[model samples]
Target: AEIGKGFLLPSASISSKTKEQMPAIPKEIERAEEEGVKILYLTLPTEITGKNGRVNGLKCVPLVLDEIDAEGRRKPLPISASEFLLK
Candidate 1:
């Protein structure tokens, strides 16, 4: 992905004991601050949508990387825009 033209690669870390991958939300926040990103668009699962209409935390969902479409490309994950804040 380009610096500001394309999407940033998903930032995550893998657990040593359980071998489970975890999203590095703090790291992503740091990166956004460093890059001077005013608004970061995130697509977290609906399960994480918190109380008071806020989304909190991250949960890793297993994906079959080998699965592809007729174009041999991975399918895009579904996303629903819950709320939008504008200044």
Candidate 2:
């Protein structure tokens, strides 16, 4: 009960997760930028989103797509389940 409550609070749940990413995340983002991999969306279609817009359920891999440009520059694109899975 309390565990689920935390998700609805004043964004505390996200703060801790963000803190854990730390300085490493900035560098990782930079590297990803070079690799043409950009993070477009924050959630996946596989997860169920509640009325409050919070994703509820277990998640395995992140559903990001690698739609790089002809020059190989990664363009951050939105994703769908069937579209991604089929590819």
Candidate 3:
């Protein structure tokens, strides 16, 4: 998140179990209709326009959810984020 801000880009972090975890998702995505986010780092499944070369119509950057299991082992879980591509 800081990386974007360091570049002087507006960035926001949202939490969700899925795409509809909150009512604000749609509204946030709606901003895409105008001067919206150039890129989306989604932790959950969300809809995309599929306009660019973005694989599976998902966000550009995929985040890893590092979690600990019952055995107290480290695990890297992918939260369904896809490859980042631009047209």
Candidate 4:
């Protein structure tokens, strides 16, 4: 992931099990910038089973398409699923 105005990118391999790119909400990003967090690591959540001891990757439903109007206009829409993977 890239951060800061210079867009310093991280060199890390995301697992294939990762479903989607975790989005940084504008508000949170602004706050992080204001707080002087030039580089931030966002950890995603993983699914656990049984006694919640073992992790089984992450479950996610990607946002396919944004809602459209009859005139083929786009509208501001929120993300659908909240699935994530912590690594």
Model 3 misplacement above 4 A: 1-18, 39-41, 44-76, 79-87
Cα lDDT tens digits for candidate 2, 1-87: 223334543211111112233345677655654544433233343433344765444332233435667997553343444332201
Which has the better lDDT: candidate 1, or candidate 3? 3
- Candidate achieving the largest lDDT: 3
lDDT of 4 by residue, 24-54 (tens): 4667655754655533233222353333675
TM-scores of the candidates in the order shown: 0.23, 0.25, 0.26, 0.23
lDDT of candidate 2?
0.37
lDDT of 1 by residue, 19-65 (tens): 12324566765575466554333323233445587655544332233
What lDDT does each candidate get?
0.40, 0.37, 0.46, 0.40
Residue 14, candidate 1: Cα error in Å is 16
User: Could you give candidate 3's per-residue lDDT for residues 1-87 as a string of tens digits?
Assistant: 334545554554433333443355686665642443443333443345453664433343355646767888544345453544433
Off by over 4 Å in 2: 1-24, 47-86
lDDT of 4 at 73: 51
TM-score winner between candidates 3 and 4: 3
lDDT of 2 at 61: 29
Q: How many clashes in each structure?
A: 0, 0, 0, 0
Q: After superposition, how far is residue 67 of candidate 3 from its true place, in Å?
A: 16
Location of the lowest summed lDDT over 10 successive residues in candidate 1: 13-22
Return whichever of 2 and 4 wins on TM-score.
2
Which candidate, 1 or 2, would have the higher lDDT against the true structure? 1
